[model samples]
Target: MTALHPPGARERHALVVRGGWDGHQPVETTDAFIPFLEDHGFDVRVEESTAVYADERVMGGIDLIVQVNTMSTIEDEEFAGLQRAVLNGTGMGGWHGGIADSYRNNADYLHMIGGQFAHHASKPPEERTGGQSDNYIPYTVHITELGTTHPITAGVDDFELVTEQYWVLSDEYNDVLATTTQEARPFDAWNRPVTAPAIWIRQWGKGRIFVSAPGHRLEVVQNPSVRTIIERGLLWAAR
Candidate 1:
């Protein structure tokens, strides 16, 4: 897909805040995007902490904020500055636990993110063998009708992947782009089906927010389809 901003346009600044639980590979996953963002004409700045958000001038100057911190706490002042920045039109985007499952205790943060991780379906501990890894599940993600025409998802076909399928607590405010079906699993045995949004975008004040729920593993992030969706989403969310 073509970039939303043409070459030779003024450079857009992007800030990537990464750090929290190491299990999320915050640094590694976020590092994968620095070059991509730079190649797309963004002046990228990566920080290992949210302290940058406390500086109003810095936050105000940024065009996009890609946060990859998982399960971390944000100071009141820092979060307030971020809130003001986005409200003033700094776009925000991230995937999986980075954005969706972060700052668990911060209700205001969750409100801006539009969703929070509920759980990942996994086999009951008792049913698992030693060293078994049953948390990963294979699933298919279908692009919604709206996605067919949405800039971030246009021309992207439905794809299959095996990863941690997250069931999130989401709001109707999100413009859902794609979805996955959660069928009965031994982890939470029940004869029913539930649908969860796999990719979505929304507006907060003048800013745009984009999220994808399939980036738990490096392979997932490296997948052609997933990478394309995210790359486009970043551009779409930029100011």
Candidate 2:
């Protein structure tokens, strides 16, 4: 069967950005997001830039950006440039800890991303010191009321998956697209209940942003439904 985002459709464009620590799986992870655009006709460009910060020209000529950078901090100029690029309507998308957990030490980038990774809403804190892992587990996703009628989640259901299910503390400003009802975790000291944003789309300046809190591994992203979420996310996030 043909890929989801075939390149024969039209002239949609995207930039696949990959760079960061190896443990977070940047190179392989971003590749997972590229073919969807390629299969749908977006002329995709891949930049395996370890120095996306130093090169400076990586974001040039791109209409959309799909970032797979994880647990890495960028210089002010580099981060700001990419933020400006996306804010100017070039589009941006990512999942899990990459965009949300990126630059934990930097507030500007955190503000740009709109949320921080407080903790894995599902996992018990006693299970590990830091909630960082590439484990592939299955879980269900609950669509929210905000943008459920939108094109992105139009066909997606409250489906289950054997993959990472991200629970993010999102900004109230986001146009929430979907969510998951995380069961109450008594193990969590901050404890009450855990229900978090599974996916969200935000508008910045002249551009758009979409984020999904899943895809811890390549296999997780390879799922047809997961692929669909990323594909529609790209189309929706793109200017």
Which residue window of length 10 is worst by lDDT in model 1?
A: 124-133
* Pairs in steric clash, model 1: none
Residues 1-239 of candidate 2 have per-residue lDDT tens digits of: 37564355557778777766676677787776666676666778776652453444656556788877777777777777787677666888887676777777678777777766676544444444554443334567778765568899886777777655666777798877777655555554655656788788888787788888876667666667677887788888876
Could you give candidate 1's per-residue lDDT for residues 65-155 as a string of tens digits? 9988888999999999999999999999998999998898789999998989987776556756643156776789999999999989999
TM-score per candidate, chains pooled: 0.93, 0.82
Judged by whole-model lDDT over C-alpha atoms, candidate 2 comes out at 0.71
- Each model's total of backbone clashes: 0, 12
- The TM-score, computed over Cα atoms with residue i paired to residue i, of candidate 2 is 0.82
